[model samples]
Target: MKSPSIAKQLKRDRAFVLMFAPVLLYFILFKYVPMFGIVISFMDYNLFKGITGSEWVGFKYYAQFFENRDAFVIIKNTVLLGAYKLLFGFPAPIVLALLLNELRHAIFKRFVQTVSYLPHFLSNVVVASMLIMLLSPSTGWVNRIIEGLGFPAISFLQESEWFRSIYVLSEIWQQVGWGSILYLAAITTIDPQLYEAARMDGAGRWKQTLHVTLPGIAATVVIMFILQIGHALEIGFEKVFLLSNAATYDTSDVIATYVYRVGILQGGFSYATAIDLFMGVIGFLLVYATNQLSRRLGETSLW
Candidate 1:
């Protein structure tokens, strides 16, 4: 049989097609068109000269980046921070969703969820400001409590040792509740009959969660995990920039902040672009490899 004409198809689903038009235009304009700028990473691109007049430098910038003394340090800090965030951030929502699911009191559960989720709405500047205020050594409430307990008021934000921990915890506080919404949505799709069967089989809450609830939502969990791993390196710029100072740069510096400092603040565009391209390649590889692994092991993948 012949396929329907484009005009006929549009006529049948015109409303849906109209809704999709803006999304299609958005990708074409903002996403696809901007990909052409990646070529500038291979060139010593000058703003005045433009991409066409820019000299082709091949991989010189990339080589320069790798050869820098701080390159390894910066990359190490980025990887470590990203790893810490993923380690603590990924599983937190699942645990929270399970707990939220178990709450029999609707009013209490909703109140808790609402309070938890509110943090996600705050801008990075606001969140970072709050962290700075809370972690302040002299007048901060946290230090006040510590001093009351007879401990010295050690500066949390100033100390390099505390940067990673503070960053990860703040990220969790800001994101965990929002992340749980997805897991909760997945949980609702689980078969009600499965829970009933588990109860009949003498399964307790924990046992049912282990055997039934987890397995039922396994695909969603695995997919989300793979995506998380894929973007493991693309840490946010705003929070890190706001939270970091020269004293705490040892642990707080990540690639995004590095790019902002070198590219935006210092105007080392070509070098920064090379570093960004390098990170993009790694991120792409991570996503592809994880997707393949998920397909093999769990038969679930973004593809």
Candidate 2:
């Protein structure tokens, strides 16, 4: 009887199950199946011999990665890059959404939104190329403008100090508008009567926004914050790899880029895997800590 009832309930929800089938299949194929390969991190892995035939060298690769002279440099770059993006990039979208919410003219708002969101659709290769061109000390428009203003020409991409700034700004430019969409949607779901009451109580635009709008969107902000924490170390490989050169390696080489160099380029598969696995563990701990903090603050969390 219980089995039949459960089957009937599932039959009623068959459409929902069918809708989720592709997503489940995708995770299984790309995520779960690949996770099985992580075991190679503990072995002296070789592509020629494959996983099973590779020598069992438990923890050696992990030990080598920690003891490597570049370990601190790589970790520093990863933390600083990720921290800068989180501190600056995460807030830009929320601010943009708030500003867009205040726009009275629908036409103006739509135009601004379309222009802003366009960058998110662009490929990282294109973005990096554009940045390189724009920041070129000799021929770039930015340099020309600086020269016109009687300032010395600056090579932004070559300077290690400029790498994090350029990386963070490019990220903000690409994703700010797209990221704001969720906050804007959340803002719309707030009660209209609350705003009306605030207005009646002699609240001005700033007051209304601070009191009504900000609080209304706080939950969404917290959840996004938690998600950001989860990926704190996982900056996009394509953008950084393309933008970076040997000159900027001090500030620009993150764990992902290091993994690429040692793994794909140098063919140190096992050691790279160990570093990658370490990154994943640290990232998970950060996410867990953030979620716990958010919960304690009585805000929304991914958990």
Number of the predicted model whose lDDT against the real structure is largest: 2
TM-score of 1: 0.87
Candidate 1 vs. truth: CA RMSD? 3.1
Model 2 lDDT-worst window of ten: 1-10
| Runs with alpha carbons beyond 4 Å of true place in candidate 1 | 3-29, 292-303
lDDT of 2 at 211: 98
Question: Clash number for every model?
Answer: 0, 0
lDDT of 2 by residue, 1-303 (tens): 445687897899999999999999999999998899999999988899999799999999888977888899999999999999999999999999999999999999999999999999999999999999999999999999999999999999999999999999999999999999999999999999999999999999999999999999998888788778777888889999999999999889999999999999999999999999999889889888888887888766676
Expressed as tens digits, the lDDT of each residue in 58-95 for candidate 1 is 99999999999778988999899889999999999999
